[model samples]
Target: MASNSYCESCSEEGKPIAAIRFCSDCEERLCKEKNRNDNINESEKLESAVYEEVKNWKNHIIKQINTVVEKLEIDLSNCKKKNLDQVRKDNAKISELYDSVKEKEQELKFLKEHGSNNQLYLKLRKQRKGIKDVVKRVSEMTMSYKRTLLKFEKKAEIDLNSMGSIFEVKEACDIQYKPVKLQQAQVQLVRVESLLTLKKVKTNQLNLSDRLCLSDIAVTADNTLCLCNYDYGVCEIYVYRTYLDDLTYSSTLHLPSEPYGISILTGTDKAVVTLPHKSYVQFINTEHLKLDKTIRVGEGWYGITTTGDYIVVSNTKEIRILKKMGEILGTLQ
Candidate 1:
C-alpha cells in the first residue's frame, strides 16, 4: 500500500493516485501519465526484488555449507578415535616387543658375565679325574691284596706241617693233636679244591666260541628275522626259527633295494619289505618258494610298519598308510 502525495496544484489532500514518480522541477508528485521518471521508479522496484532473492539464495547456500562442515567434523572425530585405538594397539605390541628384547639383552648380559663358572668347572673336572685315578689305584690294590692272601695261605700250610705232631704231653693233649691235624687237612683240601675249580672255570670260559654275532633283528607279533646281505645286494631273506634255532632260506621275491624294514602281517604268509626307493612291497610266498603279489605305494618310501588293519609307510615328508589291498587309507604329514 502507498500513501497519496501532496497535490500542489489543488492544494488538497482528497485526491489519491496510484504509485508513480516524483517531479523535482515541478515540485510535485505525479501520476504515470504526467511523470517522466515513472520508468525509472519501476526499474528500481525490479532491482530491489532481484537483490532480495539473491540474499535469500546466499543464506541458503551458507546453511548447506555449514551442514556439510558439521558432518565433516563428526567424521573427523570418528577417524581420530579410530586412529587413537590403533595407536594404542600398536603401542601395546611395541611394549611387548621391547620387553622381549629386554629379556634377551638380560640373558646376553648374564651369559657375558657368568656363563662359565671357571672355578666350579675346574673343580668338577679335577674331581672327575681324581675319582678315575682313585678307582684305578683301588682296583690295583684289591688285586695285590688277593695275591697276598693266597701267598699267606701257602706259607701258613708249610709252617703248620713243620711245627706239628712232635710234642706229645698227655693223653688229652694227644687227642687234641689228632683233631688239630684233621682240621688243618680239611682247610688245605678246601683251598686246593677252590683254586682248582676257579682255574677250570676260567679255562672253560676261554675255550667257548665267540664267533656268534647278531645278523638282523625283527620285532613283530611273531618275531621274524630277515638276514639280508646289505653289501651283496642279495634278496635272499632267511627266516630264522628262534624257538628251534633253525633258519629257512627263501630266494623267491628278490628285493630290488636293501631291506629297510620288515613287518609280518598277522594270520597271513605275506611280509612287507620296504626298500630304498619306491620299490613296492614284495610279498614272498613262504609256503611255496615263489614271488607273490607286490603291493604298490608312493615313491621314495623309506620305512614300513603295521598297525591294526593298516600298513603305514614313511617317506621324507609324510607317512602314507594303506589297506592290505593297496588302497591309500590316510596320510599323516
Candidate 2:
C-alpha cells in the first residue's frame, strides 16, 4: 500500500477526503484511522530480514575460520607424532642391537679365555651376520622416517566477491521481488590429471619361501609395503622397505591362516586384513608391523576395504558392510 492517495469511498459521496493509504491488492482506498500509521510496516519487515542475513553471514565466517583452525591443529599434531614415533622406534632398535653386541662381547671374552679355534671361528661368523642385520635396519629407519615439519602458510590474496546486494523496492510491484541468492564459491584441491606416467623407481626381489602366493599388498605411513604371502595353508605378511632407492626386507607377520585381502585404515597406523581360513578380518599395526585386536566375522572373506569410518568386505556370494567394532550393517547378495 502507498500513502498520499485520495479515499475512493469518500470521493463517490461528494466528499474529497484525503486517503491515508491505498492497498495495491484489490485497489482498495482507505482514510485516516485513529492512532495508526501502517506506512513503515513493509520497511520494518525488510529491516528485520536484513538483520537476520547479517547474523547468518557472521555465523558462516566463523564456521570457515573454525575449519581452517582445525586443519592446522591436526597438521601440527601429526608432525609432532611422526617425529616422536620415529625416535622411539630408533631407540628400541639401537637398544636391541646393543644388547646383542654385549652378549657377543661376553661370548668373545669367554672364547678368548678357554674356547678352541673352531668355536671362535663360528662365533665370529655369527657376529658378522648380526652386525650386517643391525646396519641394514639402521639404514632403513633413516630413509623411511623422513621428518615432516608442519609450518603455517598464510594465504596472500583472497578475491571474495559480495555474497549479494540488498535491494530496495522503489515501486509497489517490486514487492514481489525475489532476494538474490549467495554466490557459491568452491575451493578445489589440485589433483593429478589423466595420462599419469608411472615408472618403477626401484625394483628388488624378495627372498620368498616355498609355495608363496602374493595375495594382497598395503603401503604404510612410514613408506613400507606389507605384502601378504600365502604359503601352502599358512600365511606370512612380509613388511618390505626401500631405503635410499635400495629395497630391503623389514620383518614378517606369521599369520595362523592364509590371509587374502588387505587395506590400510584411513588416517591411522593400522591395516585391516581379511583371512579367509580364519573366517575373520584382523587389524595389523603398520607402525610396528604386528597384529592388533580384530573383528571376528565368521566366513571365508575375500576382498576387504575401508571407508574412513566403516569396513567393507566381500566373499564368494555376498558383500558385507561392517563397522570397525564388528557391527554388521547390511549384506548384499
Candidate 3:
C-alpha cells in the first residue's frame, strides 16, 4: 500500500491536507494552493528582471547607432564644404585664364593692324613673342585643370539626401526559450587525403661578371625574385624574372649600405630591405628598382617582414615593431 503525505504548511495551520508535490530543497511536501502562489511570484520576478535587461540592451545598441550616424553626418558636411571651396577656387582660376587669353587676343589684333609702321617692327616682334608665350602657358594650364577635374569625378561622391535609409528603425522579435533535444547516434570515421603533389621544378644558376655573396632573397607575387648581393666593394640587389623552366636577370639596384634581410611588400611595387649593423631600413620601389624612402628604426636590425601597415624587425635580444613610416611602436625583449 502507498503512503499519503500531508502538507507541512497546512499541518502547521491546523488543517492537514494531502500534498501533491515534494520539494527537495525545502525538504517538505507542498500542497497545490501554496505551490501555485509561489510559482506565480517567481514567474513575475523573472519577467520583470528580463524586461529590465532587454531594455538596457536596446538602449546601448541605439546609442551606438546614433553615435555612428552623427559621425558620418559630420564627415559628410565637412566633405561638402571642402568640395564647394575647391569648385569656387577652380572657377576663379578659369576666369583669370579666360581674361588673360582675351587680353592677349586684343594685343595680337592691334599689332597686326599697326604692322605697316617700320619704326614699330621691333615692338611688333616683341609683342608677337609675348603672345606666343602666353598662348602656350594658357594651353598648359587648361590641360592641367581638366586633369584635376577628371580626378575629382573619379573620386567617391557621398550622397546625404537619402538619410532616411540610415535612420530608419524597426521592431525586433520577442525573446524565446526552448528545450533542446538530444539523441544517441553512431559516429562515422572518414579517411583524409593530401591535396598537394610535390615535384622537382626549374632551377637557374646565376652567372654574373661581378663577384657576389648572396645574403637574402625575396620574391613577389608575379614570380619576380629579388636577391641581395653583399659584395666587398659594392652592395647590390638583383631582380630576376622566373618563367616556367628558366630564370632571367631583369635589373639591378645598388644600395649604399650592406643589405642583409629583404621582404617584398604585398600588393605594392615596394620592398623593405634591412641593413645589418645599421639604424635605418631602405624602402625600395621595385617598379623602378630604386630606393624610394629610408626609415630610421635604430641599430642592429636584421630580419624584416611586413604585417599590414606595420613592419616587424628582429635583432639579437629584442624584436621591434614599427610603422611603415619608420616610427617605432614598441619593443619586446
RMSD of each: 56.3, 29.4, 23.7
Evaluate residue 79 in candidate 3 and report its C-alpha lDDT on the 0 to 100 scale: 76
Query: Candidate 2 — what's its lDDT?
Result: 0.76
Better of 1 and 3 by lDDT: 3
Candidate 2 local Cα displacement, residue 302, angstroms: 1.0
Poorest stretch of ten by lDDT in candidate 1: 146-155
Q: Is candidate 1 or candidate 3 better by TM-score?
A: 3
| lDDT of candidates 1 onward, in order | 0.55, 0.76, 0.74
Worst 10 residues of 3 by lDDT: 178-187
Off by over 4 Å in 2: 1-197
Writing each residue's lDDT as its tens digit, candidate 3 over 1-333 gives 022366778888987787666554455666787788786997799778777876787788779879977987787777778777887888887798778778866765776687656635765676687678777877887676633221223325755344232232355422122221110111122335767888877657888746778888998878888998776666788899988787999988888787888988888888999887567899988777778888988777888899778899898898999988878899999
TM-score of each: 0.31, 0.41, 0.42
lDDT of 2 at 103: 88
Q: Which residue pairs come into collision in candidate 3?
A: none
lDDT score, candidate 3: 0.74
Instruction: Rank candidates by TM-score, best first.
Output: 3, 2, 1
Writing each residue's lDDT as its tens digit, candidate 2 over 1-333 gives 222255667677767776544444435455664113345675688799999998899789779979988998998898889888878977898798788878879999999889998999898987897889878877887787655566778787644465567786676331121112210111122334688687877667788787789888888767888888765676788888856787688888887778888998889998999888786788988887778988988968989989888999998899999999999999999
